[model samples]
Target chain A: MFENLLTWLDSPQTLQAIVVTGSLLLFGIGFYGLLAYTRIIKILISLSIMESALFVFFLGLASDPHKTAPILGDLFKNFEKMNDPVPQAAILTAIVISLATMSLGISFAIEYYKRTGKNDIAQMDALGEKR
Target chain B: MTGFITLFTLLSMSVVALFSLRQSNLTQSVVLFSGVGLGSVVLFFIFNAPDVALTEAVIGSGITAVVLLIGIRHMHKEPEIEEVMMENRRGIRRIAIALLVLLTLLLLGKTLLGALSVETSNAGQALLEHAMQAGAANAVTSVVTYFRGFDTLGEVAVLFLAATGVGLLLTVEKGEDAIYIEPNFILRIGSGFLFPLILLFGLYIIVHGHLSPGGGFQGGVVIAAAFLLLFLTRRRFGLSHKIVTILESGAGMAYVLLGLTGLWLMGLFLGNFLPHPAEKIGMLVSGGIIPIIYILIGIKVGSEISYVVEKLIKRSHDV
Candidate 1:
């Protein structure tokens, strides 16, 4: 049974499964940290981790063993040489978008700390109104 | 090669992720996240995306970690003894989202999966076949600048929008002195050397992006990093607001002028000004208006990011 399971996990079909499983596990842990950690930064970090996992799931599937990088040097000038570049372009935009978001998130964390002198979310629950 | 690496990496990331999840400390979590980032970077390389890999290295590891650590400094970390108080838990919201997402994924998963398999080999091949005629040796840059010039226009607009949103959300009602961080000796000396080097390289990247993998957005980030270094090392880096504002306005104006000018010059909007002779690739002057547009966009994006960061830090302090 163990041998069969190991073989199954090692199969090409299981590659994406492994990635998906890893991503979900990362999400779960981040969520757990978000729940378990009171540090405001930790929570945000967890959120970032969750976001990275999703990016992984998307890009991991696009990679094929047969294809080379989209970059063409002297050796791989032909059409048969490269993998997809669309996802690469898409992810570049996504990475930039995420940076803007994380920075904004940090700025808010700083302001919240200044105002309340507290960073723990539980300590931060002062109704919907700002004092 | 890519497929094998991708699979092996996916497996390795899972093992590392599991180890991290077990650690239960905020710092360990960050390390785990870094592992995840490293894996994603590998996936990017496997998928043949140098640009994305560069971004993931910077944003995913460096910036995200810094931001997270900053957040952690302010927020309380749950001690081992404290009752885990899940405040105003969004269990219902989570369930609703999960259900909605599941339903959507179930319906669209096949189609979405199918879309990935549906190769754009024809389109990519077409671009590759006539890459010389398109005026850029880098096919990705060619598609971005020439084949889809209008889309490139909107992408620049989106960067503007993101900068604007960061501005709106993070700014204070009135300006104040920037955080009076006296530059440390190492950073002070380092910035002196590093800032000029960064600017020089950024220009090189944007100028040569037609033949290389770098382009406006990537080079823009490089330029922004130089400004960021200044913003860090000098409390009174003393950017002349007037100059920055002028630079911003000029870049925006130039993009517009180029577009309108193209109507007369090439009879199409944003057309490459110098006509590339068919099948002539890799000439510095071959890509014509494309390299020019990308350089302009790089300047625009760099200035905007610098302004946004400066404004955010400046507004946070008391006048």
Candidate 2:
């Protein structure tokens, strides 16, 4: 039974399923944190978590069993054997852009914290009260 | 084996994320977030993208944590750990949110699973076949700096604007009498020793970008990390804002100018206008205009991030 289970786990299809499920689990946890947390920074962190979860999902989605990196390095030269570079490139751009967004969000959070001495989203209902 | 490793990594990262969220202390949260970055670095490697791995390691793990710590330090007070009343912990709200999140996750997972079998697009296949014509060993670099050079240009601008926004938000008159925590003797000495090595490594990464797994962004962030280390240990060491600004803009202009030159010569913006031996692959000088553009990117990104780090560290004291 243990040997059978090991064989089941070894399949590429099973691995892809595990990765996809794991990424979704991460996304769920991040969403839960976003809902549960009131602090502005905590929400930002949760947002970052969600971003990472999507990244994992994207990279995992493009993963293939026999293919290698797209680089034309010493041992690898054939284009046929190369993994898809499009997703990798897109992910590269995504990572940096997300960093920019994260920094900007943090800056706004810091400014907000300074002005109101409060980081909790629930308490920040100035607009609601005015309405 | 790769699958097992990835499973372990993803599991650990999720645990770290959860733990970080649970922590009330700001510094602890930053540290745990860095742990998540480190785990993602492993994942990037497992995915066979070393460039992304390097960027994730340097920018995601190193400089981000340092900047956050600096921000935390400047805030003066400890982060508020709000007490929750039993009545405020609405069970209905919790259940609703959980159910919503589960549904979303299920949808995303199913869609992604469906996407797994899709074949590579014709454009992607063409890019794979003809990537060598650009004379870049790393196809990702070619895609980033050559095919999507315009996007990279825009990304750099975004980074520059972010630094500007951070400076605008955090601006305060330089605190002449700012308290400097005198670092321990070991830390000071170790940082001093490690600083040059880190800088050298960063430069090596930038220069060998075409031949290897790292490029401008990774190298620049690593360089910034080195500067951050120095800033932490030696509080008196000042970064001139004017110099950093000049470097940032100078490199940005150089990148644009290179692109324009490509357009002028080759009749295409950011085209391989510069003379390079396309047949000779893996050589440092092989990739036409790619190496130069990456170097420019390295300088721009390095200065911009370092400037941001310095601003966060210096101005956080005022607020």
Per-residue lDDT tens digits for candidate 2, residues B90-173, read 674489567866775675476446655433334466788878788888988888899889988998898889988987887657
Off by over 4 Å in 2: A1-3, A125-131, B76-93, B100-123, B176-179, B316-319
Tens digit of lDDT per residue, candidate 1, span A1-131? 86675665445445555555556555655565565555555667667767777787666666554566665456744445565555556666677767667767776776676566766666665566542
Worst lDDT 10-window in candidate 1 chain B: B114-123
- Pairs of residues at least 3 apart in sequence or in different chains that clash in candidate 1: A39-B76, A41-B71, A41-B72, A64-B3, A65-B1, A65-B3
Q: What is each candidate's DockQ, to 2 decimals? A: 0.31, 0.45
Misplaced by over 4 Å in model 1 are A1-40, A76-80, A118-131, B1-4, B11-35, B67-84, B87-132, B168-186, B263-268, B312-319
- Model 2: per-residue Cα lDDT at residue B259: 90
Strongest candidate by lDDT: 2
Query: Residue B291, candidate 1: how far off, in angstroms?
Result: 1.4
